[model samples]
Target: MFNLVVEMNTQKIRKDFPVLEKGIIYMDSACVSLKPQQVVKAMNCYYNEFPACAGRSMHKLGEKVTEEVSKARKIIAKFFNAKPNEIVFTKNTTESINLVANSLGLKKGDKVITTDKEHNSNLLPWQNLAKRGIIHEIIKSNEDNTFNMDKFKEKIKGAKLVSMVHTSNLDGVTIPAEEIIKIAHEHGALVLLDAAQSVPHKEINVKKLDVDFLACSGHKMLGPSGTGILYGKYHLLEKLEPFLIGGDTVIDTTYTTAEFEKPPEKFEAGLQNYAGIIGLAEAARYLMKIGRKNISKHETELNKKITNELLKIDGIKIIGPEDPELRSGIISFNYKDADPHEIALLLDSSADIMVRSGAHCVHSWFNAHNLKGSARVSLYIYNTEEECDKLIEEINKIVEL
Candidate 1:
């Protein structure tokens, strides 16, 4: 009886995220996930037991706290199948990308390939580089929101760097990453993956994938905000310039000149978000224990059930990959005559279903695809089938209005 069935262990899981205390269904994990008890406790441990700065201290308390941060780096590196030296802590995904973008030795006439599907976080750095005479080419996504791989390859010829959003935030379209990375490597183009959405839902093997650079935010994955990761090959990071000066990033400084520390330290400037990052480590551990495969399966089922039922309502249009397996937890759609914001308001007021309805920081994608806006329902491992039923019920009422 159990052979063909796999049920997520949500009872134990829901207890971790205390925000369920709201007495409402929270379904917007794609935007920012609710924190678990362990994550909260980790933050508490820092403040209660040993609250001190990381990486530049002689006192026992400071050294111990710093070691925890260092241990977190090792855990993150092992998770990605990389060495500890490859990861750098940043404020969020945007800051992570900027660390690399500003550090690059890019100049006039250098080429970068990206897509219209990218959020502003992934798109703006290259656009800014374009103003300095660096070339930025927008690879168009097909009508169904899938990337055109053949066209992407054709565009990669002679490009110095290629960067794309790993999973689109607007439509939840997962690009064929293995193909993209392989082709980019063949073309001598460095690939950077904006994996803000993918990290929380999918199994990532940076070693097996051989992706040069990757960025993700902790908040999007059941962790704290003001926290994120930037990963790069050690050699590439060593070659890039420093993003900021002063403080620990510098090895030595005088009135006239300064020398910077190696790769990871060089990128992290000033005092950082210690507590948020500590919570991020705890969140990653929680996800690993539960298993990413199980998480993906649970969310895919929810997306399928919600997508099919929502589409049955008259005048509704579902966006992104029709195949639930092609994406993860996000479901973005719109009603023909109904505004997305209005729809969201009704759902929240009447059904207590929490979701996000807006451009979701991907305005370029919407304008490129000729869409107004969309209502998005993103699920996490803690979400249940009963919540899906309630959402479907509320959507039906909204359409009838």
Candidate 2:
């Protein structure tokens, strides 16, 4: 069923974002969401007020920074139903996946399973493991581009890790991650979910899902850039190796050997994005304030409006699931014989409609399907129904032109 459960105040929410006032209809939130005033303020608070290093400094400013950072960690952990220690701040989703890939200690003969629809962040890490003699198995999607659980079940055998994207950026399809996690565990394989898209729109309980690890970016979820997190079960973290090490990662050090700190610390080497972390915490709070359930429903409602109108236009092909409920605020499509890039540029120049038109970092999927790229319109809370109308109007104009 469609998940529109909460009542939303779109006008109020739109006010928090200044860019909405600029007359530009931003439909590329899946690429990078515009930062709200609260997030920007939080970042500014760090730089202007208490700009200092965290964890290492013993001074007052340092202590304040460390305290704010710890609180941010707790807030992020709570959102995922994870322990505070389980959250390891990384640069972005790519680094988060790379952290798991590097630390998993995969041998030449070990198997890693993923899907054909994964963004390169999730796909390439596992592919790179092949050079270490680690085998990579990719399960093909169904004809409609939906994840084929049957194929997933067939290929998960003898796999050391099953890493998958929770949501497809290329098609806006949401995978049944809980079911996938259960099946992978039954087969004695660890599961990692690339939640870069899912975390922004819905509430995810890692504990309930029983996912071994997850990676997400803050930038896509109303937080600052250079901020993201890798979450691993505490016990499993103890087993995985640290991807990067130096500075605060170690508890004790000698000229030749060093004793590393615990999981989160060991993984976070050197200086971190202190401002980004604090800003991310504020963004998390902002999302919670509005409620993820409410955000999901609102975005879904908006997506359905656009989807319904788009389907009526002749020669316009909507990608992913036919059901608007399944698309999750992202609508990617191609017009008959029209280049997606050219369409995107025209839309921008004509009406200030910002959409993403490219392989979207899932070039493997595009290449496999023998297509070039599709124009994508991704929504967020700040978008209005009026904006959706304008988008449809522009699409019609483009098609006619």
Candidate 3:
């Protein structure tokens, strides 16, 4: 069922995002979303009312900051169906993934399995660690940009870690996470999912999904930049070696060995983006206000029409599923002779449509599929059917040009 939140409360919800009043049709949510007024106000409040280093100072302002951070943590944990202590704030998605690659206690002989459809943030950390003597294996996706489930099962025999993107940036396809986790856990392998492209568009229950680790960027989901989050199981985080070690991360440090603070605090080293974190909390709150279920339905409703309309254009080849229900609010396509960046320029200048261009950091997918480059039109809640119509019209003009 499609959600009617946007239709039912358009006036109230649209009021929250001041940029919506400026009359620009934004279609790049997969790249980065525009922030809502509520998030802006929340960030301003942090800087104006109570801005201090959380968990460090003892003053009232500092305590207030601490309480604010704690509140955000609890809110995020509840959103992800995780425990408060299990969540950690990171600078971005890359940092969150690196935390696992650096601290997850993988041995020299340990094998980590990844997908062909991974963003660089999810793929490179472990791949770069090959110099450290860890074995990295990439499970290729099918021709349709979906995972080869049987092949995925084939690679699980010797893998110690299964790190994958829950939703792909290149194709905007959502993988079946529940099955992925179930099969991997049976092999005693820990699973790490990059939810950067899925969190805002899908209904996620990490607890029910049985994933050991998940990472997402706040900015991509209409929150402030320089903010990302990592969700780990409570016990797993307790045992993890802190990836970033410094300042507030330690209980006691000396000339000798240093003893670290517990779980999340130990993992969070130094001063964080107080304003960004607060903004993210407000963004989550705004989503909660509208109900994520409704958001998902509305997005899916738009995706179906957009995907079908786009595929009908000549020389256009979509990289992911033909069915909109199988993907999120992303459409990756390429004209026969046009470079993706060139196409993006045309779309921006001629149609005023903003999009992403290139391999989208999924180099493996491009290589396997023989794509020179691709352009992506990523949508969000604020995007409308009228903009999608314009996109299709522009695509027709580009193809005929």
Candidate 4:
């Protein structure tokens, strides 16, 4: 159903993001998205109009802040087709996954399976569990970077949990999340999806995916930084223990013993990011208005257009899957005898193009494959065909020189 490619009004959509008018071609949405004016204004209203703590003070401003926070939670919950209480606020995707890893109560010799394509956020959490006597098993992809479902099926046996990245930042490879989730459930293993890369660009229904836990960041999806969400089924959340304690996380506490709050409140500790959360709600609303399916189609078309032109260069090499249809909005490439960092600098200085280079926080994957990093170009709803043409024109100029 998601494979359908529809057209988007790029010129009209571009007006929503103020940064696009600066003549800078931003292709780094995978790192962090450009926030729309609506999102920024939402945050400003939180600080300027109602500058009060939620659920703490009894003043009118505090009451308004509490209502806004509750409304924001419902908005985010509806965005992912999840219950409001199932959503837990976090610092970012890194903290969200760590919360799951530490709270899962892994025991000595319990097996946890993951893939080689995972970003450091998903990979490091499971690896850290090894110090606690948990066994971390990694499933390697094929030489062509395609997932080997047979290998995944073989390793999922007797596994306590299966964690995977829904979409890859390294190469824009989108995994078969539904198929993977089905296999993990059959083996009686809990599944967690790192949706930081996928959720921003496409639609993800947690109940439909049937994932035990899912993590994504607000900053990567057009909200403010230092805000994220961890969605867990109520039953699973009740079974897992809370990693952080004290403050509002507990309903009551004594010096000797404490009674923690339920589900989300139990996971969330200390003062929350009120402004960022409100901004994130506005961001979700903005994306919802645009339609996730349409955004996906627009990004895929842009990636294909740029990739087709890049392939015509003699020394150019595309990373990850060969087909543009199989990838997300990200496209990574490297040239013969040219350093990726130098090429990126040239693009930034010469054309004011913004792109990311180097390991992209997947250093272990690059080291395992015995290769250097590549330059990456990621797109979003605000990007345009003219920007793509300019990027290609500059790259071709480099090749000729």
Candidate 5:
């Protein structure tokens, strides 16, 4: 087996996550990653030092909060190669996508295209828009659950917006986003990417992709929960109406009328999660330092090891593409006639291995395929070869029963 644990400095990385000391193997990063001590300390610094509202208070504490929050915004923007003013902070990826769905002002008969393999966050918003007379179209995937470019091309004829998941949490397949975005633009359609899974494991430059809008959760990237970002081009953000309007969203207001703040500020309403923002920025910095390319390589190596071993077991059915490279760091599979939840329980109880089960918020895909669910093992930078071995050993034992 390849020894990437040392090459990736995974032991040193594990030291930053205190939860790893508990002797548990965590392979569920697709849902929420374990926050490092650096992120926690950054958040603690915010609460303990400033503990004041940003852009609202005029006192020293407020000024400090505002400065720190501004810095956090710039850090996050740089992480995605976006302009500072283009970044809008929201509660999570769901809220970010919802903001676009509500603010984009899609009129009756306007067409929006998405893939059949989308997470519910990317799917439901357009479905709700359909209720208001928008035409929602779902392009079905290939037999192997890969994106069908031919189908997408056929559907993109008159689409108003094309919102798709960059990397699927269900099976870890990353669509060809850069090409897709280019084609959508040629068709005079705006593209919004649900990057909740991609941003954490891969390098994504919004400027490079030329995608109109992108949404991702900080919690999935070793940051704090309740922190996420919506990135849009400055001009587009200026044209779209605010999703949630109140307090910080406006510059000044009369009883009858209100003058709103610019792009980002207008979109970010109410008192924000100051501590979480600080933590999320620190998380971005940490990931940058480690290098997303190296992280992707490390996870792919681990996934290769796990996928090869799992395929050796009889009655094991792997999901998505057969190639581990295409699936990134996720291995989702089912044993014949086995309940995925029961398999998850067995792994947790017998080996202290934490994995995800069920449809992983892609219930529509499961229903379409007539499947119940599958156990998912998702890897991250901190995961090691030893842990992968342990997972394989435990899964082998479970299959025997």
Candidate 6:
């Protein structure tokens, strides 16, 4: 039954992405996934049919917009096994992380822990806080770039918060979040997962993980760009000072003061992205229907094929783990003495293959290791074996050159 479902989803997946019709092999899902027709249609419906503000107006179209936005929130909440009130909409993962960084109420001298491999979105906010007297510490990864739980255990002591990446976009390596979250809770530290890379490819239950907060971007999960979600425990969200205020965030305002609304409304300031929110919900719905396990499995198979073929070529260095299974859908590598951007451009010109190159927003890691950058090929459910073959072929040519 599972195989049948996977087969069915695979057959229908390409049709849903209109960009695939252009015969281009898209391998940059780690940066931004191609949106599906369902998500596009949902956003279009919001703009064309009931284009109005949500939660303010009482007219028919306004009410419809309000209802639809509420429904989107619920769908997104259910997708992560979170309560509707616990979910807060933000522009993207960057904004979501910044929201928590600014609002989490960490005092001077309070210790905060993070992994060394965090993206700039997860790294900069804490670094800024450190400049203001918050003791921000980083736990370096193992030699293979895997999470070092021992280092984490040592660093986590006296930490008020542990904000780390659930999956490293730099290498496609996922940390053991369940174990990390458990240890953090035992130490009385609140846990916030930078789940921008994990949530779209796997099933994540915020309650099960016992994560205090989680942040992810919709654009990486077949949703529209400029849409993202931040999920927190209801109590934690309630306690947080509002990151952005004014407009819909307040219930009543006086000349002296303004009374704020609760949880989600308080966090989502000003006018919301109504159409983007609707599209994001549809994207979540589409992923649920397709099954995240299926997507993960399909991506791993492609990665294995690519990794095996690439290994046959001399001086072709792959990042992260030696095993493709450990890297999820990503295969970030570099040819000997080759500029990653030049290789990316060559691949695009030669084979119509699109891949991401350079530091990938994790410049700290590259700088720490005294390296430049690597070419990354990130996959998704819509990718196929033929696409992997073309990638291998082009990469082989690039290496030969």
TM-score of each: 0.97, 0.98, 0.96, 0.97, 0.99, 0.98
Report the C-alpha lDDT of model 4 over 1-401, residue by residue, as the tens digit: 12224456778777888887888999989999999999999999999999888877899999999899899999999999999999998999999999999999999999999889889999888888888899999889877677779899889999999988888898888889999999899999999999999999899999999999999999999999999999999999998899987677887878898898898889989888999999999999999988898888888998999999999999998888878877779998898868888888889988999999998898888899776888999998888888899999999987777
The sequence of per-residue lDDT tens digits that candidate 2 reaches over residues 1-401 is 21233377788888899988988999999999998999999999999988999998899999999999999999999888899999999999999999999998999999998888899999878778897699999989888889999988888889989999998888888899999999999999999999999999989999999999999999999999999999999998888888898889999998999999998999999999999999998999999998998888888999999999999999989888878899898999999989999989999999999999989999998998888999999999888888899999999999999
Poorly placed runs, candidate 1 (over 4 Å):
1-7
lDDT of each: 0.85, 0.91, 0.85, 0.89, 0.94, 0.92
- What candidate 4 gets wrong by more than 4 Å, as runs, is 1-7
Q: Candidate 2: where are CA atoms >4 Å away? A: 1-6
For candidate 6, report its TM-score. Answer: 0.98
Q: In order, how many clashes per candidate?
A: 0, 2, 1, 0, 0, 0
At residue 199, what lDDT does model 4 achieve?
92
Candidate 5 yields a Cα-based lDDT of: 0.94
lDDT of 3 by residue, 283-332 (tens): 88777766777777777777788788877776778888788877777888
lDDT of 1: 0.85
Model 1 residue 223 lDDT score: 81
How far off is residue 128 in model 5, in Å?
Answer: 0.9
Best by TM-score: 5
- Would you list the rank order by lDDT, best first? 5, 6, 2, 4, 1, 3
When superposed on Cα atoms, how far off is each prediction in RMSD? Answer: 1.7, 2.0, 2.0, 2.3, 1.2, 1.6
lDDT of 6 by residue, 281-343 (tens): 999999999888878888888889999999999998898997999899999998888899999
- Residue pairs whose backbone atoms clash in candidate 5: none
lDDT of 5 by residue, 1-401 (tens): 33484446888899999999999999999999999999999999998999999999999999999999999999999999999999999999999999999999999999999999888999999999899999999989998889999999999999999999999998889999999999999999999999999999999999999999999999999999999999999999999999899889999989899999998999999999999999999999999998999888999889999999999999999999978999999999999989999999999999999999999999999999999999999999889999999999999999987
Error of 5 at 122 (Å): 1.0
